[model samples]
Target: MTEEAQRRLLVELGASLFQRGYSVGSAGNISIRLEDGYLMTPTNSSLGRLEAARISKLDRDWNHVDGDKPTKEVFLHRAFLDARPEAGAVVHLHSTYATAISCFEEAVIPPLTPYFVMRVGRTLPLIPYYRPGNPEMEPAVHAAAKGAKAVLLANHGPVICGATLIDAVNAAEELEEAAKLALLLRGMSPRLLTPPQVDDLLTTFG
Candidate 1:
């Protein structure tokens, strides 16, 4: 996509996520990998009201090049993109259900449905907590990304990567639904997909 197209799509999708309550009060960030570098939401910018031309642009080395300043949580996105070269986009959101699950000791939401396995993979590890906006969390996130496309930031939210922006957003949404299901099914023996079933889904859809 052209730079302008990517910027427009980012704004459109960001607004959609924000309007749906996936992000609120500028509590989330997004970035897309570009052939030249990256385009990220500006710091302190509301995802619901992004200006396409004012989105921050960074060089391949992450140096700010144009538009507004990038989000302070740039390292979070960097961690995922660096670890997964195939990833074309990264999304971080403090969605309610996913964030609530992050607070628990068991961070890995089980495969309660086939879609969860198809979109979010087999396991979602909980990265050790780090103060918000702290670059120190990058290494931990990067390490976890080696095994999974998504990881819940303890007490923070979820960071997800995908081959494209839509895929990343879809995975995040699926994760949120799965988290909600897990919470709703608490204390009940909900029928979950068998390992063989999960393996088949991963093989077919992943």
Candidate 2:
């Protein structure tokens, strides 16, 4: 796709997430890989109010080359993109329930539903927390992202990747929903999808 089209798509998707409360204020960032570089949401820009023409553009070396400045958490997106060449886009957000799940001792959300198992995969890595924008967490995120579809940041939120930009947004939405379900069933003995069930979903989805 052309850069202009990608920028518009980001604006559309970002607005969708924001209107649904998946993101608030200037608390989230989105990016798509490009043949020569990348296109990312600008620093401190509200996803609900993204200006497609002003989306930040970065060169192959990650240097900002046009439009607005990119998010300070560029390290978060870079880690996943560099680690997984197949990851065409990344979406990082501080959605409510998913952030709550990050604080749990569990490293991953249980297989609560077939759609969750299909979109998020079986192992969701939880990275130790770092102050927002700290590059110190890059190595850990990079390593884990190599083999996982998504990772939760302790006391923070989720970083999801996909083969396409919309896929990333969809997975991000699914994760938040699953997290919400997990919280609702917190005190109850919910029947989770069994190992074989999860495996079947993965095979079918794949």
Each prediction's TM-score versus the true structure: 0.98, 0.97
TM-score of 1: 0.98
Candidate 2, which ten residues in sequence have the lowest lDDT sum? 103-112
| Candidate 1 global lDDT | 0.94
Model 1, stretches more than 4 Å misplaced? none
RMSD of each: 0.7, 0.9
The segments of candidate 2 whose C-alpha lies over 4 angstroms from its true place after superposition are none
Query: Residue 7 of candidate 2: its Cα lDDT?
Result: 88
List, residue by residue over 1-206, the lDDT tens digit for candidate 1: 88889899999999999999999998999999999999999999999999999999999999999999999999999999999999999999999999999999887688898888988998798998899999999999999999989999999999998899999999889999999999999889988899999999999988
Spell out the clash pairs found in candidate 2. Answer: none
Q: Write the per-residue lDDT of candidate 2 for residues 40-117, one digit (tens) a residue.
A: 999999999999889999999999999999999999999999999999999999999999999887845888998888
Top candidate on lDDT is 1
Give the winner by TM-score: 1
